[model samples]
Target: MCSNYDSVTSPERLRIYFGVDAPAGSIKGEVWPLYQAPFIRRHPHADVGDDAVPPREAMAGLFGMLPHWAGEVAFGRRTYNARSETVAEKPSYRDAWRNGQHCVIPVEHIYEPDWRSGVAVPTRIQRKDGKPMGIAGLWASNRKATGEEVLSFTMLTINADDHGLFKNFHRPEDEKRMVVILRDDQYDEWLDAPADRSMAFMQQYPAQLLMATPEPQRGRRRTGASPTSK
Candidate 1:
């Protein structure tokens, strides 16, 4: 359900956190901060597995099915988040859930709306410690009979904590949910664990590390009921 996120951490910040040097040798913050819903980011080969083509490149086609895509012709309105609890049962996410289609959503923060008389009041969520959050994600590869590959991703959802709902920003009255957040120690398990074990790893995330607040959010709403947090 967590669709909005901030990936706009500066390259220098990433290098310091990672403690690794980049070849560019210089860095600065990106303009137009990385706030985005990130629906179907990078698109579909990412789910099935990578054998020949690079994984990131393999995912473009899958985004075609998402509602927010902005290609020459994009679906743009249908790109929605998937839920972690019931993903295995939904037709749109079943295959990825059962087949171990996993990924990581890296972000500096996420935006949620607090409903003030039906108006979505945007709020920002971030790691309690000021580090980046690595959110749980699902990926898939869409292949046709023609032998083309497409990759895509969707965030998983969970029930919202009291702080995550009423106290969180952009609180929509109709929805009470949030996304599954992974701990730094659980990143590898999330990305590489088998289907059953992966689910277990998901539960290990601590509640204390999760945090939220009111912050500016990006994206224009077209129409629909309040959406579940990714």
Candidate 2:
């Protein structure tokens, strides 16, 4: 599962790659669960079968998904990633998957663990070409009692037990998996396709295009919050 990733691509970069309007806010660097990050999705009109308007745009959405029935954002902690094999059956993602709430999460790289040394060491994985990756994802929006709308999303992942690089990360006992990174040519079709056809875009990216290196975890920065508050 991809819980943490680098989202340092500037808004200008997104505009160029995705051919969509840039989000207003600055792009996040280290995007952790629950943090707001930019995601590319079909324009609202497209969802309603109106093709006269623009096709897609970029919006800031929370990293984790919040089912409409969920009372608070805390429920998102466990919904940050939805397994591709069962996303259509899982309560948290079934509706979105069926309703065609697909999105593309842009990231510079993703973090994983390397256990070859007998210990789990954090590793940074990115495309060998140094280009940003567009990970397939599902999104949902819920209105709060206070009349506020919350936009959230979850990255889709598939079993990577046979993947040359992905299978080396995480625990050996745990089912190996990796987020589905979409090819540049597949982005438009992925966002415009219907729910049933979305599954066809879940194939693993070629292992030859990826590279990984051990990266020591950085020290936590000090915050001004009091110890009691923390």
Candidate 3:
């Protein structure tokens, strides 16, 4: 359900934050819903002098599934998130769950919403402490009709126990529950955890460290909002 996120993080910052050292200027955008970057994993060795982390080779993109994935390929509707709880039973994810694929999805922040007015008012979700947060994710390589190869991912979800970060997602029509929040020390385990332990890492939530900001609405008029002729 994490369809939008800020993919414009700096490579140095991303390296320090994710330890994979994405190539410079490789950050996607502020509201990314897909991974069509020509250089997806360009900087597999991004480094900012943080403690020794895992090698870039441990990272995997969605494309890894192609040239072999026999399932129907459709991304217009299929997304990245696979709830850890039922992954073992779901047709779209069960196979991947048991194999323990390694992946690292870098994100700066995400957009959630409040649909009280029957219209969604976007609320930007980030660390309450102003630090970036990484949501545990799974990626798959897909082939587009345009004949271009791409990678995409999804963020897992869970109930909002007390974070109040997304009570709006639980609305009657929403009924959304699942989330993917991880700690720095838990990254390795999350990226490589077995199906049994994946749940433990996916359920962290880390609400105490998260903060939400309502983005400002932009003026719609071509020139600008103006006083009516009196």
TM-score of each: 0.63, 0.89, 0.71
Which is the winner by TM-score between candidate 2 and candidate 3?
Answer: 2
Better of 1 and 2 by lDDT: 2
User: How do the residues 1-230 of candidate 1 rate in per-residue lDDT, one tens digit apiece?
Assistant: 44445553354644444322222222222111111222212224546665553233211222212322223122212334665666667666666667776766555776667676567766676777988766677765544422444344666766555543434444444546666777766665666667777567444345566665655445543443234322
lDDT of 2 by residue, 1-230 (tens): 88778874586778777877767665577877777888889887856766666678888888888877777886677788888888888898999999989999888889887787788788899999978899999898977522578888989998899999999998778788899999999888888778889889889999999999888774232331111100
TM-score of model 2 (CA atoms)? 0.89
Residue-by-residue lDDT tens digits, candidate 3, 28-144: 455333343211221234355544534443232331122224334443234445556666675555555565543555666777655766766676777766656666665445464
Winning candidate number (TM-score): 2
Ordering by TM-score: 2, 3, 1
Poorest 10 consecutive residues by lDDT, candidate 1 = 26-35
The global C-alpha lDDT for each of the candidates, from Candidate 1 onward, is 0.50, 0.82, 0.51
lDDT accuracy of residue 159 in candidate 3: 52
User: Which portions of model 3 show Cα errors greater than 4 Å?
Assistant: 23-27, 37-54, 57-76, 142-150, 161-163, 170-172, 216-230
Alpha carbon deviation, residue 78, candidate 3 (Å): 2.1
On lDDT, the candidate that comes out on top is 2
